[model samples]
Target: MHETNVGQPESNDDSDGIDQAWLQRRTAAAPLILGVVAIVTSVLMLGMLFGALGMRAGIDLWRAGNRRWSVILGVALSFVGVVVSVMCAVLWGSVLASVLLSRDVLRETERWRGQRVAAVECSMLSADGVRVSSLHPAPPMDRLVIVFVSSGIDACGQALQDLAAVAPDHPTCSVLLVDRDNSAATTRAFALLHGADFPVLASETLLPEPLGSVAALPTLVVLNRDGVVECAVVGAHPRSELHTILSGAQPVVATEPKETQGP
Candidate 1:
């Protein structure tokens, strides 16, 4: 048998070198383009100011002159300069605003992508005040779970109503009600109204930090079994979006990553 190298490419060094060179060139060019823009904006503003000054001087000179042509020229130049200066200032302001907005958008994107949260260890307390943490380090699966945290009477009552309305059809689906109040009255009400099926967790802690800010009075977080946040909403949602999220089809609004910027 002839000696041969199996699955060997002839040469990648040349192509690799080309790719590196191209990347370097592109990186270098980006700053140069920004610098050029700044310089151009500055030059245009200066030009506009000078034009206005020349126009004013011409007007003065023409007024002092015995001839009509000198006066006309000076007045025309002054008008031209003023108009150009206004346009330049407006354009510069607009460009500056856009640059700032883009930077903000990019920073937000990087913040979300860079942030990683550890998987959650879920615990639940029944209306009877029983604690259940039996499953520590629960296997991170792909199923969807909604956490409804309530503080006041209205929220707790509403959650019970909603869960009762939604849970039977979603047996695999878990609804964790984190009640901070934990009052006997609240506990009794919870058990009587909504405690028959899904698990309920009570907490003295006010809120879940990792979820960040919420918009509406009632908040809903749809998390994957892995504990990574899949979708989140602050207020009530349309029946359609809610159903889709429960079905693992649509992502919650807050989970949609914000716009990003490029260097």
Candidate 2:
């Protein structure tokens, strides 16, 4: 047989020039390869990272000699990737914040139950700037609903919205907004903003026993004529659910706050 160079390709030089050939091939393909990677990653939400890689490779390739379509394509991919990455970042950030809020609301709700003890008549400063010292009304209303809230909390905000709708419909029931952060002025503003016409009360200390442990906002404690807790729940409730809880004509499961409107 004629001289046979077993596995080596005829076009590839011997070891002396192999490195140079390998480097040339690698340099030529890098921009196109990275550009494809960046484009693919853009669809998978990893555009920003791969985009940077493609940009460097494209710049290096352009500096070598000519501006090929591959070089332009590489640069274009970087621009598109950067834009896509920024938009996705904003959208995902908003979604993450909302989920975190809901998670906090659910955490507080899942652990607590309704209290049947005396409604702790802690001292409070009313929204009108008058000092009051009771969880109950002067005449002792037929029913009482005390809502605990903190400033800038979404669950509390949502609960207040529900209260605005149901509080007025049931005049016999007394409703009060208890401020957890001692933000009397802010709470008053919140009450007005959410349309909760009920009394907004704030205290500098933790509310008394059975309630002193309350560390979460948007906690609703319902009491009977005797000023004893009949139902206590955490988290935001819907208008209809609030109405039912206040009415008591129907059985109200108030140990844990529920998503009354969602499927």
Error of 2 at 35 (Å): 4.9
Runs with alpha carbons beyond 4 Å of true place in candidate 1: 1-116, 120-122, 127-129, 134-144, 151-156, 181-188, 191-197, 205-208, 212-216, 251-263
TM-score of each: 0.41, 0.60
Model 2 clash pairs? Answer: none
User: Model 1 residue 202 lDDT?
Assistant: 43
For model 2, residues 1-263, the per-residue Cα lDDT tens digits are 67978887766454566786666666756666766676677656687888888788778778876466767776777767867877887888889998897677666543443434444455554545666556654463677787889867877777888887877787888887778675777787777777776666655645655666665567887766655566667778777778788886643333433457966
Q: After superposition, how far is residue 241 of candidate 1 from its true place, in Å?
A: 3.3
- Highest TM-score: give the candidate number: 2
Listed per model in order, the count of residue pairs whose N, CA or C atoms clash below 3 Å is 2, 0
Residue 88 shift from truth in candidate 2, angstroms: 4.4
